[model samples]
Target: MEELTELVQKYSNFTQPMIDSLLTEIKNIQNNYSYRKFDVFIDVRNDYSHQAVVVYHKPPQVGVSLYQHKVVGKEALQENEPGVFHALETGLPSIGLLAETQENRLIHQRIYPIKFNDLVIGVTIVESDISNNILNSFRAKDTLERYNDVSATIQLFGRLDLAVTDQLVDSILVFDKLGNLVLANKTALELYKGLGYIGNIIGLDYNNLSLDGTNFKSILNHFLKVKVSKNLVEKKEFQYLDHYFTIRKLLNQENQQLIVLIQNVTEIKHKEAEIISKSVAIREVNHRVKNNLQSVISLLRIQQRRLESPELKQALNGSISRIMAIASTYELLAKQVSDDTNLASALNLLVSHFKQLNDTQNITVKSQIDSTIVIDSDRIVTISIIVNELLQNVVDHAFSHDQAGTIKLMGIIDHNIVTISVADDGSGFALDQVSTSSLGLTIIRSYVADKLKGKLKISSDSTGTTVAFSFNN
Candidate 1:
């Protein structure tokens, strides 16, 4: 308890008295709920990251131990322990959040915020062992009750003299073997009225009902006569009265009766249409952006032809390459349905384009990029620029001797950090001789450190030069 208090004081701004009060409350909870393991965690806020540290732990007396080892100083990540953070963020108890311990054992956790003067300072988590048998037993009992209720409702409909209740949200109608309406709920009666029925539909023949000169009754009669397998259910959707409706047919024992259910799904259909409209709008925007960028590239090429100075032409070529890198991103985006762009595929495409455009007669370019690495489209542009600059540097300076060489681009992701390296097997330069003021190197450094929030490492020797960048995703 003393160590837990000191750890909380070291990580949080809560006073000693407040910490002591919280500890006492946790101990009382532990004494009350002796079957569950309880742990107190305080939020540790830092400039770079927000974390929670376990300040106190109490193990259960009669059940399996949730934590075999001490967690008095362990950090709880929001990703791994959402219930703990949720309680702290909302100041409300979070219940029944499933999680796995460091040892990979699944447990059910409930978290409550520890407050002092209406200000939440920490959270207390109650973890319990998950018993599958107990859960299955409760599920079975609930299922049985639902089945019994449905059976009772169906039996009530089997009696043709009874008037069914309209309490159900869905329209329910039961048809006899002769395609005669035996029972119809009030919702079903209202729907039939909309279909141009003027009188009682309880005794009306389904095959005689006319709907817009199309025997809609014949469709229902045909379904009633169709030999469906026992316990088989068929459903279909149609549009009516500017609303969407789903019809389901259920076959009872020996196909003696057919139960029809209708549900209105107009709101769900509207949501689906909205999603499609948004997708089409996004694709149209991508298409327009790509076309505009291509026009810019064409104008740059035309201007480059008019320039006679070699240095000016080279600078223009660099600018064109950067623009082309950005254009490639939109090109890929226009072709994809998803918002995330596969960085590996995009980088490979960029490398191939560079090799084809540049004058590398005997140079071989190889890529070891992971195809599974995908990132958002906005970040993809920065990554594309970074990759283009590093690869262009290799082509211009690494193999300036016109000797046969190889340039390899490798990318891998580890623990949410993406690492990309461009290595070349060419004449390497001394690190001390490299100028920090070089435009290409400076750009690479800026993009890596500032834009990506990462670090860039460049190593060079007689063997080769390898430039690597690491960033969090």
Candidate 2:
């Protein structure tokens, strides 16, 4: 009694007379509340705004206490106990209202005002167990006791106490062993409302709300049938009403409760579809470009066949080879799904194709590139033209008639710099004496400087010719 007076004085804005009025009601509740088999308390408005503090507590002496421990000095929130605040502010009585206690338990409260000189001083609350409400619920008899035992454990694992779960973006639901939803967070309830559910979803059968039409019992059985560990979680995607969802389901082995988490993924699916549509369009464009280049090559071959002079025939062949080299890039792009080609494979393909088209008993083209690389179609087309010119120049000028020679293509990469070298074991010419007006020299220098954005290096000796170019990879 003395502590109750001190509590009112320390925390509330009550007058001395109001404190006495509250203590008088607390004394009557402490002595007579046991007959009702309920927990009783007195609450007064605190000096802080919109809160009340419990000043006295009395547990039933005849039966089990609904509260596990004393909570005399605990604050009562309006969200949890609106009835308690109603009695204190309006000097009226609020009866049979469901309220959540500070210990996270639910009970029915009956709050009555304590007043002095027509001014409300405090509220006296009598709280009883909610077993009668549970009796009317459809949740199985075994579910009630089992859910109580594991509800705290589930909240701990999810980091979702009731207060915090209301603010989460992910919808969370927990079901009992009987396939009934024992708990649902505020987000889940709102999600169901968006899905056209007009009523509360708690205590409802889970099959009614499942998007995939998989019953909860069958889901549990499927996990066992797959020989998966009971602790292993299963994740899947679902669509309902044009909304895409990624759902994860897990079963708590200790209590056999099922937990479901759902997230909307519609925007992600839309983006993926857009990317695939663009990829198909790109592949189509590359195919048409390859066909057009091949047609041009056919026309050049026809012109080469009509000519009798060796110089005219050789000139047409050079044009055809350059077109063919560029065509190879589009051909590769059309065959694969990705937009970029492997650099090593593209270079090797060029080497193999060129050797087959111009192979001779006196001339051999070999690839000695040891490093692996990948590049895009644009750069590969430029490289193809460059490498073909270098090889053609070696065939025409480096070796004399009836002379046997070998050409080796080497591609090396070091610290983001790639160097391609075409070395030929043929009679070489002097670099200073060579004509600047030479067509092959002009093509190589212009393409390397402008298209490839790289440096060109040439070396010649009495024994061999090596033409190399370097670019940033």
Candidate 3:
């Protein structure tokens, strides 16, 4: 027999310790083969490709083997055995599904992951012949008979329904034309009993047990009068005393019986409500934060009016502009109630903020940001500050006296990389002549590296200066 350890070393990315531990697990699976009559095997993803390799196989002690020959060390292609790779990649089990064998035979498979260090190292698949169990699955579905009387329905379900309906997790309830409950499954009886219904519900009206209190006459009128299709199933959600449930209603035309399937979904409904509540709370908090920042900017402007030094007034204006840039991101997040904001809307808002403050400069700012670029609110705030610094730098040094210039801001995303570039139509300066330790350059570099985890590139010529930086989306 080929060793599992040798196969792991040759075809998989498992460590030596992991391989040693896996050997013990393989032995346990081999020795403890149960009476479920299934052939169990282990498969690992190939190190360099998407294919999976079978490293171990344990044939059932009493069951027939599906494989005609040894399948170890063979590549399990996705088209043949997708459950093996699905468990290996997603760390979730794929159960009770049909899969094709290497020898071109169909078999039922139930696959689960083998995890080491929180990573799925391999998948363990349980194989069984579909011919033995496929009859039960098909019979359970197509057994809805066209019976006329209650005695016929009772006789049919008593033999077969108990085996099939009890295995189901959803509650099954059936009612006659007079709104009398004709048949109740084990799951339905247990579910209603837990909901405070006393005694047997086999003869009780379905509306008496219904949480929504919809009468059988109303259900028949709504379904049969409007929808003539007998196979059509109507769905609705209802909540009763904190328990949320979804119901599927269908009518049997041959006997004029109403059938409803109930599935408890209270946990799913609560989770959806919690997410919406948290999103709204985050939006409210962002709105309050934006208001506070705007108040601070107003206070700074009032203080700037009292200052006499030209240099102090210019410094205050720069601070106000940077604060406005940060506030614009919060405004977008507050209105949309999300963690990310539209890049186009954010850039347009920044232009409006800068236009309000630029009284002396006749430069016009035009933003051509892509509408598809969505950035996190926190990262966009950092980007807004960087753009503000570069725009102010262009206005200060890129133009001469009485020169009309335009600053073009562009945001482009290509191949999962986002590039925000700013170009101006004014006099450009030599890179070597500019100070290496200038505040604008230092701020841009620090924000791009620390906040964005990206790279910065500045290219300048006699035409114009373009400062661009790129980050992964």
Candidate 4:
């Protein structure tokens, strides 16, 4: 049994040459066994021809040798041959006659099972005479099947797992504890530009690739700073035409091995730089325009007092003030191109200018303004005229009833249109009772409808009059 077990292990990977050697060795053993005991020898086996060899031990026959690899009948032993047929079919042991001829052939055959572990494999046919004892065949079979099961399972699972793993999507990679590339997926082939070093990392030893691991430590430091996921490492940075990546170390759930993921982030970095450059340019342009408009306003105010008539002097002063109001709005816009104009700041400055001009500190002006709106200079100029005209009307007519009242100025922007209102609390005026029309209100109406392309609404209640206007920029 032990001898059969040894044979099973040794000849597990059966080949044609090994089978020929086994047949010759058995024939020699049989001849020695019979000749020493009974002075006679007998042997039988299929030869190169389709016919079976049946020879008596007394005289050797002149024919094809039985030791040849090609066993004649069916490229193997004949399937109809009793012991050989059953042994090959079920990988089990059997014993039967080779031939029924008197002096033609009568041999004893014992079959020994070949196994990997507990699995049944094809049997080994041991040919001898009837006296050699056939009980050894069953014992050999029992010993062979004891350990072959595990070996068969291993072989089967290995083939199936390899087939399934080939169909994965992303390229998976593995590295040894020494940081050598060991395993890689099919996608890695395309990713590495066909460098043909998927499993070896091009033999780049850490000492060779990095000077005392400095390069590796730099990469580790970059990754720690970014702290992006191990799977999603962004531009940690760009190098020449390529980009270097930093990824966190991850442990594989099944193998507990370390891994890192790499990607390119060159495009996003370029876009961020472009946006910042454009914003800076925009802010600079806004600053220059604001400075230019303030210079023009200063020139206009200096020339206004030279006029002789009181009406001409007042008209020039009003125009200069409106221009200054718009310049103030631009000043705020130039400070933050990223933020926008502060309408409240512009309103406060406009009210302060009017109070200075009237030389009346008692006029209480309240303002409700949204500072976030980014209105253009043209819109600001138009809105300044509208507010100036409304406030002038309040100061001239609303307070003329021997009463002091508060004025409220509010501004709001929604979507692309900005709405502004100037209202005063005082006695109302009758359309039939009023005779003279002011040139400031006439210019305000023309600018709102034609130049600013806006709508205006004026309502006179018992408390006071409200002037509202909206324009698009």
Candidate 5:
């Protein structure tokens, strides 16, 4: 056994504690059935095929040895010993299987999967005395009966394969037709322990188990009955012992069995709550900023009313427009569920405000925008200011007092590039007449070239003028 442990530790990925536990369990099994021989086999995968190697072998004292020679460290092909490979692959026990040993002696074997952390790490093979006919016949019959019972029970419970169920980290509870708890895996046991349960809980009636202040058994009973009439399973979440849990109900109609799957979602629920709280906090911040900007705008309006100089009033109004443009970005952000704003929507609001402020009844403003052009708040602010300056330039300089004209705002997206243009069909100016140092033009040029990393193109002739900006998506 010590030699076997050393080999297992060297070749397998199992920890030392796991190896010790396995050795202890194996010793207990050997001690309980002293009349029978036992051998432990581990599946090893090579480049070609899977092989089972004998790591430990114990022979019966009163019977003829199944193998005349030492069988430890022997390798058996998967095809030759199907029981070992079957238990390893299925994570289920294989009982009463007859197979030939390395020395050509027939042996009766019961192979059980050894599990750790919901994984099949190895197989434990129990060999009985095959030379005694009466004993062999009785053992084989009993094993076959037990296997049938287990197969039938599993089929009644939605045919859930124990091989897969044993590997799940979620706690599962299965109840029989009479509401007796029949199955609970290691995770389920640990979870029940956390709920203040002690000792073995198997074969207990569902209603007999005590849970502090929770009607868990009644809830299970209600769901089991409700599922039959409504054909709807209930899923619920609750807190138990400071941990959040989600319970799912599954019913097997054939035998009226019930299965409950419980998942601990404490961490996941906490993260969701944190995200929602952050979103609310950000929205409140945006609202406060918009209010503060509105207050500043109100103060500016009062100052404009008191000022007698037209030039000073005009300059104050320009500052107000720029501040309003920033406020509009925050307004859009406050109303949105996400951090991004629709460029078309924000620009449309800005354009409407400018038209009302300038009172442009002769110059008709038309917008041809791609509705899908949505951008983040920062880009929205920059683009809003650019559009505001361009539209102001057209309203103030493009048309005469008596002449009526059309100003068009165009936005288009092709492939991944975005292009926005402001064009006017009114009196045009020569390219050389437009000063680069002018405040409005300088703002537009600096924002386009520096902030947007885009190119600004201005074209003017005798008929019309157009300013277009192109940038990456």
Candidate 6:
């Protein structure tokens, strides 16, 4: 106990007056206990000894206190007891039991470690009386056993607290009623190292945390005033190593800690701003393109009226229809503003346009389609062109002037494969009689086979001509 007091007195961070008062109380405690024949030795190194107090019977002097007694010698401390070794290694407490005769010869010895910070700091070596050896052994064992029990409990608490502390993402700055940092984690240590603060953050004042130029005083003031909060995110615009961050605050009332969660939002915020700017630019471009296409369609109508020959007029009409097909696809693209175009919707629009062109109330467009079928813009345009040609073929060849017939258009999409079929109940063609000279039929076959990387099947009987194609979705 005296050795512990002396070490505290020597290396303590407290004021000198506080150390003296603590030492006085320790001496009083020892005296009240009436401990005898015990020497309190603090061994920081094997060769060095600091004897603080010794209690003994047989009156070396009648009224002299343990601290006033002359210190005993070099040879007496030569035994490198395990208790002393443990104390030097761990900065905790320990005890050593020795049976030393009057002749200053050692007989038997046992070591007990006294732990602080889960480690041994110092030891008390008790020289037992020869007559009461058995009684003293039992007493010593019981004392050491209790000390171990208390020490282990403290060690476990320290370890558990340390583990939980390290897991916290926020940098915990703990304080008493008076602010101070009693404990810190690996993050706190690294932060200080980066700042070139060589001293440990554990014992520093909580309000004095020097993170760059931002101190903890104002944060501590706010914390003390308002202890509970839902969520407090403070954008401090703090800079570290030429980078900026917003300091986030989290208060854990259960543990009474003020946690600072530092976040860098500079890059993320900039990226969001850039995306907004680009979206505005793209929308404006699309609006201009839609207007320009409408103007071109008007100019084409003016040019079609001036044509002379009926064949030339028909060719110009076909060209007008083709341009209108592409224009309609873009119109849908502009309306949805989606990169993934609904291929089913686009095909339905194209079929409607072809039916209108033919002026055929006889032909009916039936859609058995998965509405959720999605294809890219380019693929949708290609599909639109193909559908237009197939429907035109049915309008021209499949129906007679006297007999009107119903034409069916079906689209089926399964997994990655898309199949579209145009079947008509009109004058059907023989396989040998089919020719590539029909402009609409030729365009449909070429697009389905070459561009789409798909196969086209044409089945014609007395009832109808059915053109079916399977392509990658």
Most accurate candidate by TM-score: 3
Deviation from truth (RMSD, Å), model 6:
23.1
Per-residue lDDT for 19-109 in model 6, tens only?
Answer: 4444444354357434344433322222224322222112212333333334332223323232333233333232222333325444333
lDDT of 4 by residue, 319-411 (tens): 766666666565665666454445666667778867866644556788887777655555665666678778877876787644568889988
Error at 416, model 3, angstroms: 2.8
lDDT against the true structure, each candidate? 0.70, 0.77, 0.77, 0.51, 0.70, 0.55
Q: Write the per-residue lDDT of candidate 3 for residues 1-473, one digit (tens) a residue.
A: 34888889988767877887678678768777372477888888887676788888887788678888999888877656755654665566765555778788877777878888888788888888878556355344323442235677665345432333443578888788887666766788777665544334565555455555465677888985786576566788877545788887777766777777888888899998999999999999989988998999999999999999999998888888888888877777789966788888988887788778766367878889899999988788889889988988888788886788889999999998999999998889898998987877888999999999999999999899999999998
- Residue-level lDDT of model 5, residues 1-473, one tens digit each, is 68778757555667777777678766766676543544434443222334667767766655566667887666765545656665655566656555667876666677777787777667777776456773445345444443357666455443654533543688777777776666765688787655434234465545433222223356556766665532344566766434688776566565566666778788998898888888788888888898898899999999999999988987887778877877877777777777777778988888877775665888888998999988877788899889888887887788887689999999998987889999999788988877877888999999999889998999988788999998886
Per-candidate TM-scores read: 0.55, 0.59, 0.61, 0.46, 0.56, 0.48
Tens-digit lDDT track for model 2 on 1-473? Answer: 98898888889767787877877787687678454587888888887655888989888877888888778888988667866765665455765556788898877778877878887778888888877555355335654564476767455466433333433477878888898777776678777666544234577666555755467778889866886554566788877534688887776656677778888787899898888888888889888998999999988888889999999998888888788878777778877777677777777777766666564559887886744676677788888889989988887888888899998888888998889999999988888999999777888999999999999999999899999999997
lDDT of 1 by residue, 1-473 (tens): 78867777677777877887777776677667553434433333321346677776666666556677877777776546655555665466655555556566666676767788888777777777768863453345444443357666666555422122232578877667776666666788787555433334564444332111123354445655885554456667776434577766564544476666777677999999988788778878988897898899899989999999989988888888877777777778777777788988889878766766567778888899888899887788788889999888888888766788999899999998999999998888998988988888888999999989999999998888999999998
**Of the candidates shown, which would achieve the greatest lDDT relative to the real structure?**
3
Which run of 10 residues does model 4 get worst, by summed lDDT?
Answer: 205-214
- Candidate 2 lDDT at 395 equals 79
Off by over 4 Å in 6: 1-255, 260-287
Better of 3 and 4 by lDDT: 3
Worst 10 residues of 3 by lDDT: 138-147
RMSD of each: 24.1, 21.8, 19.7, 29.0, 17.1, 23.1
Q: What is candidate 5's CA lDDT for residue 384?
A: 87
lDDT score, candidate 3, position 322? 83
